[model samples]
Target chain A: DAGITQSPRYKITETGRQVTLMCHQTWSHSYMFWYRQDLGHGLRLIYYSAAADITDKGEVPDGYVVSRSKTENFPLTLESATRSQTSVYFCASFNRESYNSPLHFGNGTRLTVT
Target chain B: QKEVEQDPGPLSVPEGAIVSLNCTYSNSAFQYFMWYRQYSRKGPELLMYTYSSGNKEDGRFTAQVDKSSKYISLFIRDSQPSDSATYLCAMRDSFANAGGTSYGKLTFGQGTILTVHP
Candidate 1:
């Protein structure tokens, strides 16, 4: 498709296990972000990549790791998942070159850490 | 205290009623304001966007941003049953600073869930 795509729309994994969520965008945006949505907290940024091989921590990046090897791909990994990490993960991209452009989001991955 | 605060209302109203949603923020540096709508299991999509301060209207949806009061609002007129969803208010600072620090990040508010019944 022409929009962003997230893999594994739904996932369930045990605590302490490692899991990876994938995000890919066809627009080749310069900025890509990962956010986790939960009740009462809304959407908290986990990690963001400004460009390939450049990433930074966001509001809630303690247990999550992100890497962007290419401009179109930004994957989030939970090295040691916890029950608290059970929430929906969303990936978004933005073309910083344009001030009027808004972030384009994927449907999201529903992850359950049991 | 959070930077952005929203009512998180599970508001119910009859079809054709006027719907008003709002959010308050503590940051004055925020220059771009936005509203996003999310269905039951879908990611949020941008509904309205405004820069700095002022009101922007799009059909039945109107967005108002008042930087002086550090507040923003979204009003839906003649609401429909299909409008049932969660509305989120988000904003962020300028894209970059003098040093060229790109802050393309967004801070979101707790969403307000609304249902319009016929």
Candidate 2:
């Protein structure tokens, strides 16, 4: 209850269907991020939010959308899922005030697109 | 070349053996370095952190960063079976815009999987 949590630990969706991965943190960190992890690629950032209503793209933002309406929640969405998008998604957060603070991550949502 | 490179190793060793893990980066702008340990089906948690260059040790874990070579390393002494997990290296640039929004954004290397057999 005091840490980050992700819903739908595993998911399977058809190509072209929209799917949303949810992330919620109880720490109220100012910075939140979404990353996709795949074999050989490690983890690639999809999007990040500095604060509520402020979001920006990261290394791999194509085809994925993110929004942070509140400081405690950041959700990632695939407008139209593609087979290539099948990967484990992770959400992370950190207190921006502390430059050296490492990110605290959620358990992650495993999304499989077929 | 990718900004960060790490071997996705399934490195296996017997318990009590010293373990070495490393990562190299191509970005000269990166100033902060970190190592994370991830257990099966769990999110990664910070294991070691170093800023810029030099070495820092905590418990049986030591972190080394060489800015000149753009390399970083994590070493574990007298490893235990519980140390078996994936290790990820991450870095972030020092440059932040006037808004100070991108300072926390990190670039990660492919994780190295290590198993310490008991």
Candidate 3:
């Protein structure tokens, strides 16, 4: 119960459709990140938020938008889904104040765009 | 080339066997290294971590980092069937970025899938 959770473990959307994945953490970690895992590219960060209302782009942020309105929630939205967007998306949280805190990840949401 | 590189092996080993996993990185700024175990359909969990260049062991798992060679490894002794899963190597530059952003971000290697058989 004291972990990160992602909604809709699996999702399928048509090309050009909009999709959003929700992420929630119970620990109230200050840093929340969104990563996409593909066949050859391990895990590439899409976006991250240092705190509520503070967000930044990561390695691959194109076509994606993120908002952290609350400390416990960070949501990712795909403006127009493409077939290339089909991959497993993971949400993770880290405690910025804890020097040795390891990132905690939520069960990924598998999204397929066709 | 990618900052981190791993073989992405679907390695198979019999129970009780010794298993080795490795990753090479191009970034010299990385100071903290970590290993994560991910089971099928599950999120990855941190298994071990080491600071700078050194070795750290816990139970049957050992993590080794050689900053000079820009290589890191994970060894599992007496591997069990339950050990079957994908192991990921991750590293980050623990220092603050000059751009005023937190350098707590990690770069991950393509995970190696391992199977321990009975």
Candidate 4:
């Protein structure tokens, strides 16, 4: 019951439309991360939050926005979706202070922009 | 060059054979190396981790890291059909996310697909 969950396990949006993917965790982990997985690019970090109300951009943050108003939720928004934005998005959480803490991930939300 | 690189192989092997997956990185600052196994359409799950340059064994999985050469490897003994998946190599500077100068970010490889056939 204490696990990460991503909503809309799959999504489809038209280009120029706004889409928001939801991520929630019952574990109350301090660090939350959002990453997009592409065909040839593996997983690239889009954004991460250290705690409530604290968020930072990741390796490829363009066109994406995230906010952590509460420790349980970290949502990623695409201001304007594009065809290139079609990919699987994963949400992960961890207690980073502990070096051995492995990131716990959600099932993921697959988004496709046409 | 990418911080981490891995051979994206659909490496086919007979069941019970030993399977080796590897990754190379250019960053000498990476102090923690991890291997993740991801089944198709599933998010990667951490398989094993090594804090320093050494080997750690867990059941059928073994992880080895060599800091001097910036190479890391994961070996699966007695590979099985259930072991088939994309193995991703991830590294992090454990100190980055602390209050000091790092952010504890993770750099992951492209992933290698492995299949154990009967």
Please list the C-alpha lDDT of all candidates, in the order they appear. 0.93, 0.92, 0.93, 0.91
Residue-by-residue lDDT tens digits, candidate 1, A1-114? 699999999999999999999999999898999999999999999998889999988899998889988999999999999999999999999998888688899999999999
Best by DockQ: 2
Global lDDT for candidate 1?
Answer: 0.93
Cα RMSD, each candidate: 1.1, 1.3, 1.0, 1.4
Model 2, span A4-52: residue lDDT tens:
9998899999999999999999998988999888889998999999899
Q: Which stretches of candidate 2 lie over 4 Å from their true place?
A: B95-99
Residue B112 lDDT (model 1): 97
- Per-prediction TM-score to the true structure, in the order listed: 0.97, 0.96, 0.97, 0.96
lDDT of 4 by residue, B4-100 (tens): 9999987999999999999999988789899998988788899998997999999999999999999999999999999999999999875744453
DockQ of every model listed?
0.76, 0.80, 0.76, 0.68
Candidates' chain A TM-scores: 0.99, 0.98, 0.98, 0.97
How would you order the candidates by DockQ, starting with the best?
2, 1, 3, 4
| Reference-based lDDT, residue B67, model 3 | 99
**Candidate 3 C-alpha error for residue B23, in Å:** 0.7
The residue ranges of model 4 lying beyond 4 angstroms of the native Cα positions read B96-102
